[model samples]
Target: MTSHVFRVGNGHDSHRLADGGPLVLGGISVPHNRHSVGHSDADVLLHAITDAILGAAAEGDIGEWFPDTAEVNRGRCSSEMLLEVWTTIQQHGYSIVNLDCTVFAQRPKLGSHKLKIRQHIAELLKIEITQIGLKAKTGEHVGPIGHEEAIAAHCAVLLQRTDSLV
Candidate 1:
């Protein structure tokens, strides 16, 4: 009989905003004049989720797995990266119990897009939508995020061991 052990991990990511039309977040494309700038698609939400899962599993961070120095990572899709991380964690006998995420932006209010974002993330993780909780925030005209120069995201995940403990 194995006892279940729970692990909690937290991750955060931020990226500068560049003039663009579509901004990707949590695997969903949102209509926006500015988009995140990074080596990949720069989906801040997905990147944070990936890091959270990896941290819970004691795996190295996303940078170790996908480095900007590698040309192969350029323009890569963030959803694919998140899916790979989820698959790896599942193989290690870890199952996600829940995830709480937050995104901060100064423009293009996200209230209308929250549900879609959650759905896309759930689909990518192959988990029920209820397991994911997402929130959107504004920078309140303070920092880079408030100035509309950047977008940021944070994620906290709870994982449970599914394998038997000897």
Candidate 2:
């Protein structure tokens, strides 16, 4: 008999907003008055996705793979980070089943740019757009996100073993 296994992981990331006018999210730059502050591109959505994939494979989080303290990682692109994580897990015989993601920000309505962001993320993961779910929310004036002081993202991923060892 052949056995199959599934793994699920959830990840969250948040970054403080700054004076920058353009915000990068899910590999797409969206027009906004504030941007996320971080060592890298600070794409909260992509960071969360990377963590979810790594977590699902029992691998360490992004901090372990790409430490923010490293000068080499400064200004690094989040899409590239996500791609590298995906490659590592693929070599371990794991494939993404699906990913559901949410981004929280108070400004720059995401409805119009969601499809573009979803498509960009799908390309990074090498998965069909249909396999990814993207949602945007506001903090409802309750927290940093609501106050437009920060942005946050959450991601959940499902992965399955692709290689069967007989």
Q: lDDT winner among the candidates?
A: 1
lDDT of 2 at 53: 90
lDDT of each: 0.91, 0.90
Models 1 onward score TM values of 0.95, 0.95
Measured on C-alpha atoms, candidate 1 has an lDDT of 0.91
lDDT, candidate 2, equals 0.90
Clashes of each: 1, 0
Error of 2 at 95 (Å): 0.7
lDDT of 1 by residue, 26-121 (tens): 888899999899999999999999999998888989999999999999999999988888898898898889999999999879999999999898
